[model samples]
Target: MKGKWHSSWLLLLIAVVLVLSACSSGNNSSSSADNKEEATSSGEPQDGGELKVGLSANPKTLDPILYTGVYESQIMRQVADTLVVYNKELSDFIPSLAKEWKVSEDMKVYTFTLRDDVYFQPGEYQDGRQMTAEDVKYSLERSAKESAMNRLRGVEKVEVTGEFEVEVHIGTPNAALLAMLTDSGNIIVPKEEVEGWGDQFGSHLVGTGPFQIKDWQKDSEVKLTRHDKYWGEKPHLDGVSFKIISDPNMMTNALRSGDLDVGTDIKGQNRELIKTDQNLELLSKPALSLTYLDLNNKKGPTADPKVREAIYKATNVEEIVKGVNQWGGAEPSFMGLPKQSWGYSKDLEKLKPTFDPEAAKKLLAEAGYPDGFKTELYLSEARVPYGTIFQNQMKENLNVDVELKVVEWGTYSDTVAKGNAPMSIGGWTWYPDPYFFLYQLFHTDQIGALGNGKGYSNPEVDSLLERAVSETVDQNERAKLYQQALEIILKDVPRIELDNLEASAGINKKVQGYDVSSDFSIIIVSPNGTNVWMKQ
Candidate 1:
């Protein structure tokens, strides 16, 4: 009987073991199923990749604010992230580092609340630092003192309230001030590193951005590595390389050859080639930008307002837009800036800049250039948006004998600063603010043989601009004031209003999300984290 009982107990133990084994198998199956779903959703490819780009020329300076126009901004963009960034639609400014902001009742102070989860790009000395309010204070204060023309000059003080709060207290309310803050020229840099570098900091860049500057072969390539410790989403692409090739046709070649993922400041007949290519994609958008001839009112024939007007009437701005630029969207610039921007007065539309060659001839006769004058139009060999092509076409179309004095961009920059270049094609990257066109170009503070090439100063324009800065609360009201201001500048014709260029680009099929904008800020698509990645 004892033997029989022992055998029955052993059988019961065996049954319990079998039941436990089945339960374990079920759990293992569920865990395996979950992992498979996660892998599918994440879209993780077996290997990450690289993005190669074709650049128009080697950037002369990496200093964000000091450099103006398209090329420098494009390079600085990859290395830094601004407090406020322009939208993809180009309609307005959106929160970036500062998630939300508010203007004081008096409209003088702008207080910004930073998002909690933010980190700088990783460095060799440290892994990464969490973004703090002090960084915001550091960015604004240093930038203000760094230049004579900082928009922050209106800002009285910048203070940190807490770990993630910054207050920008202005001496007076400027409706257009906040919009200027969105420019890369006004980007916030890490204070600890930037205190003493001044202009030299352009070479050594640091920021709370998606990529870290790894290696630079000046004029050859600019290489950046993705930061795994990035606070936001990590880039899908492992790295990005900018190859300096000035020729637009060569840039197109790189894109078609599958060697370059992106190209910037693309224009002319090359534009038509990229748009028609089946293997690639085209991302084009109207930037808040306008190209105009900078007539030095400080010297020469342009000093006469009538000559400036006749020059305006004589130059075929519309033909340059339609003929020189093989692409379609570019329009003749009628106002100081594009019609889409704020402070854009329909007041300009009422006035006309028609193709009145006969009227221009009569005006020239009145200005004492009856047989047409001899003037050397200084042109930039910058390879930016086809400076050479535009200059050539413009010379042909103007029906006037004008000599071309083309110079390399680097040499031209120095020569222009010395007040040597007589008349050169200049451009303004219009931001969300109307003051960018009016104040910066015409302000007494910037007037120079070099900086303020136009040398246009009006006490009335200044008075209204001052009123817009000190008293206006509503943006639309400010826009109206700017419209009033625009009527004055356009009437004065300080510039030969040329083409309101449509920024064009050629993108390799692999570059999934990319585009060109008036601001010419490429980082907007990539953001600090989200936009970059490998497709498979």
Candidate 2:
């Protein structure tokens, strides 16, 4: 009887083990099925869709070297690739066409190694060909010789050292060269296409980039198709089309109706409208751009330093900025450099002129204008708001009579460029480097269309700016020189600093990984676009 009972107990233990194994297997199967379902529902990058983008203005040209406006760069950048790409902050660089590069100890010579895999997109002028050092040398030399912007003026020559290596020699040590190379003008172009197309090259563009120009219908739209043989991680979108919608309201409406995937330059109430909409998102990044009032330093009432100082003291910049950017797209600025700049000095904020109408009256009286004189504030249509606010402030604070002269953009820009406007509203947009802002806009040597339209000339300021560019690779030291220059410039009052603008875009929820560059550049298909994808 005892033996029989022990045998039965052993059989019962075996049966229990079998049942537990069966249940564990079933649970494991269920968990695996649930995980697969979750992944399918999650948002992931979908491939093979065309992205439609809306542009506020038509691009002037597609040629990288000859184009002067940001609108052109917006389209050219999609078709061309720069040697090195800078971050939105302009703090660092990443290799693009050139896989690697080295700067000499003296900082004059920049040697680059071309990436072996990059190939120019095929076009009407030539079949797609591998990009070599020859292409780099040709592109750089051509830009240095013929670029309208003179972006590569510092580059003396580009020499092809080997089949895949080249050297860019400059006459002087320039701290801004690396940052300058990131400009659209420096993108490598195929020699065959450029020579073949000649003067018509702007219409027939070719380059080594993720996208190839398919068609440009002037004021209608610019179409681009993906280059399947792109050297880098391929663009997820099959193509991109830039629809020219000159009116901001129409652009916003198109985005709302799902006719566009992205809308550039969304401003004012449009920004708020996008914010409230569940299907849209507003992407805004503080831009490296400024809108300021230029006080003519050559010949005018404003030429008097006392008068300029009085105007700076009388005007309330914060209130003006708030009024101009009523829908919230700008911040009041104190210095020439925008607050987003890496070299911008927080300490300089302490030096901003305090608004004191009483002190302004005293300065005006000392300058022989106790009763402020009437002057014309020249501006374009877009800047009428700034002009109105400033005109009102002068009248209210200094008992000054002001006239607002609103003209066409071309006339307004030409007047300011020639230093003809006694007081003009001018805007500048560039990289985050202080040299780009200070040297061009404040240096005496650049007293024309180059940028110094106010005729500002100070030998001490020029010396500081020159030293900042040639003295050191240490950015901290360069920043110190810039800071000293800013202090003197602030006191001189060449221009009344008003506000820094922000680049804002309206994007649909279907578009993923879209980024707004502070320099107002659009890079939707490159690495800078951050693996941008769209949902089906």
**Taking the tens digit of each residue's C-alpha lDDT, what string does model 1 give over 1-536?**
99999999999999999898887776997877677556545664323677887888777676665665467667677677778776665556678888988888898778899988877765433356777888888778766766535646677789899889988887767777677677667776776556456556777677776677888898788888876765555666787888888888889888888878887767767777888899777777666777777776767777888877776665666666666566675777777767657566665765645666678777767888777655656666542443444445434444455566777777666665555655777767667577776777765666754445667777777777777666775767777777777777777777777767676777876565555666666662354323755454
Candidate 2 local lDDT, 142-192, one digit each (tens): 999988889888898999999999999999999888888888999999988
Q: List the residue pairs that clash in candidate 1.
A: 173-469, 236-533, 287-518, 288-518
lDDT per model vs. reference: 0.69, 0.87
TM-score of each: 0.76, 0.90
Highest TM-score: give the candidate number. Answer: 2
- The alpha-carbon RMSD values of the candidates against the true structure, listed in the order shown, are 7.5, 4.3
| lDDT over C-alpha atoms for residue 343 of model 2 | 82
| Predicted structure 2, TM vs. truth | 0.90
